[model samples]
Target: MAATGSRMGVVGGSIAGCAAAVAGIRAGAEVTVYERSDGELRGRGLGIVIPPPLHRRLVGTGYLDAAMPTAPVATRVWLTRVPGERSAREFARQPSAVTPCNWGLLWQSLRSAASGARHHRGLPVLSVGHDGDGGALVRTAGGEESYDIVVGADGHGSLTRRVLAPDLRASPAGYAVWRGTLPVDASAEHLGALQLLRTSWVTIGFPGGHGIFYLIPRGGDAGPDERLLAYAIYATPPEDAPDGAGHVRWLADEHFPQEWADIVARGEHAAMTCHPVVDLHAPVAADPPFLLAGDAAGVTRPHTASGAVKALQDALCLEEALRTSPTPAGALRRYARERTPEGARLVELGRRLGRAQVELTPDWAAMDQGSVDAWCRATLAGTSSYLYADTD
Candidate 1:
């Protein structure tokens, strides 16, 4: 294996970093991880969804635990609020299968599997670059270290990504996404919405943008109390809008269905936050002693829902490349060749999806399965995605 007996430095200890560490170890490399945050990053984010096949592949490959709790959704229901209507109008339904996971739980699973790596917490990488002799160097507040190869899983503002694609920066999408998780309530009033979540994921459309709602396992348990109602609501936040839950409540109360709005606006969540949507794809995935993965390689709009999926695939592909290549350079070359184009494709797909779903503002109320299929065809523009590839 190309990575056999080699020293691998993986920057960042989140999902991408942990997964990269697992890849390095399995490829016979000695791995070390640098995490900037000293505290547990596990419970920070709310929800993540990936294709069922990809989830299965990660589990089979040992990147995730087999018994990890996940809520698998089979169909996506599109709804739009009708004025003076108590219930939202279900305009379209499609076979959109995915496994929804709590971000914390998923990261914990990966971190456990990658226990072989010496993980350094609260250590921030000051800079990373090629040593110019078929190796790389990572500098931190603690000290500097040299490695046969450095995997920059440090995310979008990565110091390592600058060494490869300094000019690359994420472009804003002129909107923002409000994300949070609500405690699932078993009250009789909310049973309808809760039942809908158990059945399928729902997309509620408004004028400027839309919202996605589903359930994700809270911690590692089952039952209504163990389930959390995770949501991502997108829209152009009006100028001078309130911050935090205030903005979320304003958006929900203004655009979402009554019951749906109540769910997102009802809870006091520690994870409630908002961020502007942006995207970027590195021009190259690797260049010899330096390689990129996850957000370090690219940041697609959340509409694509491929952020974590792309990262897991990166680690899987890296391990495969290193296992087969005769040298580290050869492995990096193969990794770059396969992932660069894929990153570009996902970025392009994300832009198209953003335009169709958010900017262009589709007529959700008028859409049925037929128009929805047509819209999907036009939006996808011949691009391939697991979400639509298997639909009838």
Candidate 2:
């Protein structure tokens, strides 16, 4: 642990920020968190996945618990549409273990874990800079504060990153993911018609893109009323396709299976959020007093299913560095050395997958189980292996 006198500032009080505050406090540093938004963040409902191994590691670290609401996923099925078929034909089924989580609920848990740390909301961070004595200065909407260290958990558009690495920015990867979620009925009439079990995460592939669907807890439980169907469709829509859910609904009509189409059409457009997929990797993750973590350091495509895990891992790395290194500068250097390559690797893997899966897709109709297995192995190579490489 650092000296009790050591102080740290964490900007962006979301998932990464909250985790960082926990790390700082546990390292014996006085920590303060500044969140830019005023509204309750719990309302931003979304779905996230944690592979079983990483989930176990986080639980061991007390960052997560089995009691947290999660929908267990046992298999991932890859399917393709066939002519006159109401549902896509399954090409491959890969045995897997994952826990699908509600984004809001996960954030609430992390926020609770960091409850002891001072958190200031509705205060936007304007700028950050280095102090001459190897410390940092944070300028917020209210005023400027000094700290021994400043962490950038502010996400893709980070002010702290501007001071650390001015040239790095999140670049669009030439595609977008249209996502939607809606309540699931107990009768299971809607989802049951699709012939997919609740334990399955289904992936349907077409000419220009793919879609994935699974269940997430609405109130952190497995009860029927607590679950919602969450889906994400990845594709490069026509230049003239309507924005947001309209584009997603149009794609559903054109490419999705009949049953899948019905599920999407039943959803209200207001519940969907569509945005371009972007990626970033700042060549260096830290510069003296200013250190970057989470989306500010690097961003891999959602296909990797590692965003939340990566962010939490960043906090753990920061904690380890502070706990082990002899000096603050040395610790920052070590953290950067360890995370930079991992960040670059994820970015490269995302590009490779984006190219093979979206840009230059294979003929789904022609692929057999063998070919599907080979293609999937090639595309997803190294992903599972890298899940908890540093921590484990």
Off by over 4 Å in 1: 186-188, 220-225, 242-244
Measured against the true structure, the TM-scores of the candidates, in listed sequence, are 0.96, 0.93
- Candidate 2 matches the true fold with a TM-score of 0.93
Top model number, TM-score: 1
Residue range 87-201, candidate 1, lDDT tens digits: 7888888888989999999999999999999999999999887676779989998878999989999998988899898888889888889888766763236777788888899
Q: Compared with the true structure, what per-residue lDDT tens digits does model 2 show for residues 1-392?
A: 44255788999988889888877777778889999999768767588887777667766877765567878777777777785666767787776667888888788777877887889999988888877777998888788999988999998888888887888768899899888877666324665533464768888888898888888786643462367788888999668763556777777777777777777776543257887888899899877787888887888887777777778888889889988877777778888999888888888878877887788888887877688767767776646434222211
Best by lDDT: 1
Location of the lowest summed lDDT over 10 successive residues in candidate 1: 218-227
Model 2: ten consecutive residues of lowest lDDT: 383-392
Q: What stretches of model 2 exceed 4 Å from their correct place?
A: 193-197, 220-225, 268-270, 381-392
